[model samples]
Target: VRLAMGARDLENNTVEVARRDTLTKETLSLDNIENTVADLLDDIQKNIFRKALNYRQEHTITVDTYEEFKEKLEEGGFILAHWDGTPETEERIKAETKATIRCIPLAGDTTPGVCMVTGKPSVQRVLFARAY
Candidate 1:
């Protein structure tokens, strides 16, 4: 969020408030400016967070096979797939698809499964993404 006050506007007792997230601007009176700015800032924070969470949820994908993993990799975003928990398998996936394990998420779907690539037992799904 940004606040701009021009000398001309100072004479008129008004200022401009610009929201970075939405790229919107409004002219507000000097009276209660502090409270107005504070409220706008809080609202902006919440809006940005909601937008990011929605984007992540929409982009995240789950795959059960190596073919599906490779197919999804081309489309981009986070891929949740079983891994054998071995460095060699990790290296092979990265080498093949240019996607690396972003993390072993601590939350959500903890059920065990077989690795998509190696056909070995996997403790859980790991996040994979190609660095931007």
Candidate 2:
């Protein structure tokens, strides 16, 4: 989230802008206010997207075994693991690790594999996570 506040002094024809993202304040002439704010908004959007992408890349993990999955779950992030398309297996994993399937991602690697927990045939890896 980004916040910008402007304190305008009409008598002096000056606008002081405080930016939340950079934690900086700058005084600008009235003529530059619109252009400056527009630029800052664009920078804020790119900054937010970059941070989120970095975080996901850092936290997301792919595990091939239940032991690895449970170990990673303790650290708390998204898990990509094979799931044998079965409710019973899904329920067991949740009951055991308190983690549930967040999604069967439609993108990325769709290679078939054996279930991490059941050893049954799995169509693809699925995303798993625990509520934060």
Candidate 3:
């Protein structure tokens, strides 16, 4: 997600074609290997999500009620849930479900309510992650 012609100024050691992550002691090279690795992983993750969503689009059935939503959540994969972005509720949700805030999605609802798990107030919706 970053671009550069020469990143030697920001990087640690540059041995002609390699850079090192000073703190972690990891060595990496630029303009090719690192970029290629990142590109490959990004593509793979995107493809995986696309395939999963396509499968859901083709095979998964939709339901009409909150009860149905909850049932689907119990089975889990991806579920769109309403959330208010309070840190306590976020933490509580993660604690109870072993899921954490993943992404904010686009924009989330601003409605306020106590967290279903912790009874603490919350303010915005974000992904609650418990990945398989």
Question: Each prediction's TM-score against the native?
Answer: 0.89, 0.79, 0.39
| Descending-lDDT candidate ranking | 1, 2, 3
Which parts of model 2 have CA positions greater than 4 angstroms off? Answer: 1-8
For this target, which candidate reaches the highest lDDT against the unseen true structure? Answer: 1
| lDDT for each residue of candidate 2 in 1-132, tens digit (9 for 90 to 100) | 233334436666776777776677776666777787898888888987898889977989999999999999999989999999999999999999999998888998999999999999999999999998
Sort by TM-score, top down from the best: 1, 2, 3
Give the lDDT of residue 14 in candidate 2: 72
Reference-based lDDT, residue 22, model 2:
68
As a TM-score, model 3 comes out at 0.39
The C-alpha stretches of model 3 lying farther than 4 A from their native spots are 1-49, 52-71, 107-124
Model 3: weakest 10-residue lDDT segment is 17-26
Between 1 and 3, whose TM-score is larger?
1
* lDDT of candidate model 2 versus the reference: 0.87
Worst 10 residues of 1 by lDDT: 1-10
Per candidate, the number of residue pairs that clash is 0, 0, 5
Which candidate comes out best when scored by TM-score?
1
